[model samples]
Target chain A: MSGTVGLVLVSHSPDLAAGLRELLRQVAGDAVAVTVAGGDDDGGLGTSYELIRDAIAEAGSGAGVIVLPDLGSSVLTAKALLEDHPNPQVRLVDAPFVEGAVAAAVIAATGADLDTVADAAEEAWHARKL
Target chain B: MPESSELTVVLPAHLHARPAGQIVVTAARFTSTVEIVYGAKVANARGVLALLALGATAGETVTVRATGDDAPAAAEAVATALRTTS
Candidate 1:
């Protein structure tokens, strides 16, 4: 099966990822798939990677994943997951949790290409247009 | 997927960086997707920068919408959370 776009949202607070998903649904809806991991009270960095990885794995083949992080270990954790999975198609874009979440949601819903989805996320972050 | 429910909230206080962070946290809770829309502008509910860009202030009405299998529940929860007085 060809790789599909998957959303892996990691945030300092699990609520952040949940919120992003809710927001993304507003525009995008069910066209895309999302897996969320994080928001543990412990605030440990190591756990982030595990959660992201697990989410991606659950998404399975044809679901290329994009990660959205809140802050503090978000980027680090995402990088680590990418290293472990090493899927050329699965990308861990450096997008703010909210921006990336929305972008991914929209792209996935519309069936946009992986690169295009990432670009949309980056634009959303930079646009910062509320 | 278009959401079946939508709600408008006038945040109790200015939605600043910290609150934006809170909003992001809220968005992350559900499987559905959410967005923050203002007049002629929209921001990702999960993106802190985008929410801040909206420049929402105390008492500013912002529309938050959600869609998915759990769209209705998610929308109610978000609206309740956002509308709460800080």
Candidate 2:
């Protein structure tokens, strides 16, 4: 939690979130705080508001938190949490899940500010897989 | 300003997400404007998306160009990052 910008990955699948965490650890190292908020309370394929909220709080180290969601409900859950909590340091990025996570993780690990990390996450939207 | 260097990517996995992310991080450290030229494609070194778009594979040669006060260091650092296997 001492890093510049922490990350919360929201997904419908726990394995996807865990795999992405491992991938981010390999790319960005251990400097940034990466928390996973995937699946529902029952460990099913759904987004959990409590999980997202808890992850944002856990990952935040005073600098900021960037949340990346995989799909529809995940995004809605994260946005809903933001609306209810209204934390200025939190950002919900509309970006590709894996790519955005990697990009943001690398930038955040460098001790970048919240806006910079958010920008890096958004930039992943233009990533060309072809 | 305007320093350039050619580097061969030696990573067995090529310029995948991890290495491309590393390159972006390394290039972002300098104040220089860095770019990676692979064949006909030119990618912004500071952007992970652009770097990944280059599709630079292992053993492929790419040119690193930079223009700023830290151009030299930027070019060298980017080159080193590309040349690194891990």
Candidate 3:
């Protein structure tokens, strides 16, 4: 595992997360680690703790992990999980999901560190045009 | 000193995600601070979302500017990416 920062996207819909993952892969190739925690245990519209937990574990590629949750309770579920198993390297970012992931992935693929990845994601929301 | 280059977007469908990604990849290869300017919008060239949002379509000229040690090469590479998809 390289020292590049990885990303975990938490969305309520499985397909949404998958599509976004595909998009990121197209851009960053295999340079950045991007995993998704979408849908519930039943594969319906919801967030799953197991999915989120496993995703972070899988995506925590030595350097750091940044988790971006979709909306509403998805955020809550991710927050609750993080509160219990907090690692300073694992960051839960509040930014626009698609834009943030794109920015984060691009920067991470450049071999940027944790803070640079987080800053890129956070800055994405402001850089987005209408 | 800052270096700058300009080119027309030849990619079909304008500055979408894929072409934007190509531009980002090129811009990331240098130590320079790179930017893409289209109309009133100036986007950080290393950022995919910002470049896509610049909204430059085919035939529309965009400028690639950079400031750093490798500014000239950085600006040229980004402009080439805009002119032809990789």
Candidate 4:
């Protein structure tokens, strides 16, 4: 549990992030902590800075934390938070939302390191859904 | 020694997300290096996205190969995981 890398999924739509989190839990099991920060403060379909910051703080353990943002603004929000308060254990990976989270979760379930988890998520960009 | 198995995917959706995750979990159980070979693509069995990207479908054949001290067991275990992926 301590060795498992945690994941924070940031999305504009709350359902999208929550759904992906559920799927990740099912695929990777609950051994790896999978958290989500979705929607804006007003309950609209947009990214929220506070939500992302809180989720990252919640998901970050001593082992490591990998954050996957679903949209342009989501990425911006996450990056802003990271730039404001740098955390060495946290990294934002550019990967396809669903595939990337799935990849990261599965590897994190195996207690892989942060670098390995990030690589797995980034590798998901090449996941062909044909 | 290295071991291998040519398995016909029985899963309804081929190696979709769930089934691929199953393979990843099973392959992670052994110390061997597990690979699934389909056409010219060879993916590490522990990689869900890579396994899904193999584009292998149901009724198609994929070779499961494992190399390490526990290669034979790893191969057999992954083969079984592939076959029972419904």
Candidate 5:
């Protein structure tokens, strides 16, 4: 069994989430489980509780799961989903969408623990774009 | 022991998230303190954010330094990873 943690990216645009997943796959390779939950069932630009919940379940590999949300409602939706399911192994990180996903995915691919992976995601805030 | 080497960034994608993440992952494999230096900025090689912040693009040159019991191996690993990233 793999001890590597998984990642879930939540965004208002399905394309944004899918793009991030693809980028992360390139960085972390197939060793890390990356799943995306974006847009509503109708493919509109909005968050859905069901989509987030399903992503959480799919991304978890029995080690742990870290969720990165893009903006306002996506974070709220993930929070609500966690409130309903309440898994201790899951974390919703408040960080930049793209940077955090890449950072977290790399850390997770290294087989770091949940908190370490979340910290790596949060560290993305310190990244300088200059 | 502290060891250092200079390697040119040959990746077409430069030090973007993918290659930078790969460098960070490789650097983390060692017990040494790895640092990548580009121009005036130096980044902790073990952190993807710091690595990406270095802004070392393709065709640019970067210095990789490591310090610890495994500095030699760590430096070699980091330099090789950067040199071979495509």
Candidate 6:
């Protein structure tokens, strides 16, 4: 089994995803296996899923993709993709939009698995006291 | 001539560049020295890395105190800025 955890960022606006990507790059450095799949500005329900699906597939097998969304559509979009994709090993982490994004990228780039990264993200959320 | 005001405002998220940037910008608007007190450490409003090092998360209030001619307004500005999203 491959040990790389692929990451996908899905946000309502591309700016959020782009901002997250920039932050991740600054924190994670250049050696991480992360990809960004930001939604387009057209604003459609199912559009984001396709981008997410494409990103995951492109990342290849044994690569767990973590999706970070801005709001609203991301929850549904991630759910639909996960249900249709049907990868038991592939984790669909519902991390906090901003905090989780940074945490997930930081964890993933450091060579942790998707599950571990997701756990870290969850821990960060609880720490937020939200 | 100025009244000093100090209060704790829990950061709603981890201290990062965006939030730090907002804080620095707000602090620049005032003449008071804004200090964020976490534990025994105190960080200047202008240092982003220092603020992030606090690792302050939501619900964990950090004490903010200002001493200047406009201390009350300064403290209030900091509080309001923290309430706004970056």
Give the best candidate by DockQ: 5
Worst 10 residues of 4 chain A by lDDT: A121-130
Clash count, candidate 2: 0
Q: Write the per-residue lDDT of candidate 1 for residues B50-72, one digit (tens) a residue.
A: 77688878878988888776778
Model 5 alpha-carbon drift over 4 Å, by segment: B1-13
Q: What lDDT tens digits, residue by residue, belong to model 6 across residues A1-130? A: 4655666777766666767778766655554556656765365332366677776676544757666555677767777888987886656676677666665655555456767767756655553321
TM agreement with the true structure for every prediction:
0.55, 0.90, 0.90, 0.89, 0.91, 0.56
Writing each residue's lDDT as its tens digit, candidate 6 over B1-86 gives: 76677988877766665565456556766888888887887877644445566776676778888888988888889878776634
| Model 1: how far residue A121 lies from native, Å | 0.8
Residue ranges of candidate 3 with Cα displaced over 4 Å: B1-13
Candidate 6, what DockQ? Answer: 0.03
CA lDDT of each prediction against the hidden true structure:
0.68, 0.85, 0.85, 0.86, 0.86, 0.66
- Native-referenced Cα lDDT, model 2: 0.85
lDDT of 2 by residue, B33-52 (tens): 88888889999877776777
lDDT of 2 by residue, A33-83 (tens): 999998998899899999998899899888989999999899998998899
Better of 2 and 6 by DockQ: 2
Ranking by TM-score: 5, 3, 2, 4, 6, 1
Show the lowest summed lDDT stretch of 10 residues, model 2 chain B: B1-10
Provide per-model DockQ scores.
0.13, 0.57, 0.62, 0.65, 0.71, 0.03
Q: Candidate 3 docking category?
A: medium
Model 6 error, position A11 (Å):
0.7
Tens digits of lDDT, candidate 1, A25-124: 5545555677777655465323455677777776545746666666778777778777866887778777666756665565555455688777767776
True lDDT of residue B53, candidate 2: 81
Ranked by lDDT, the better of candidates 2 and 4 is: 4
Candidate 1: C-alpha RMSD to true structure equals: 9.9
Q: How does model 3 score on DockQ?
A: 0.62
How well does candidate 3 score on lDDT at residue A34? 90
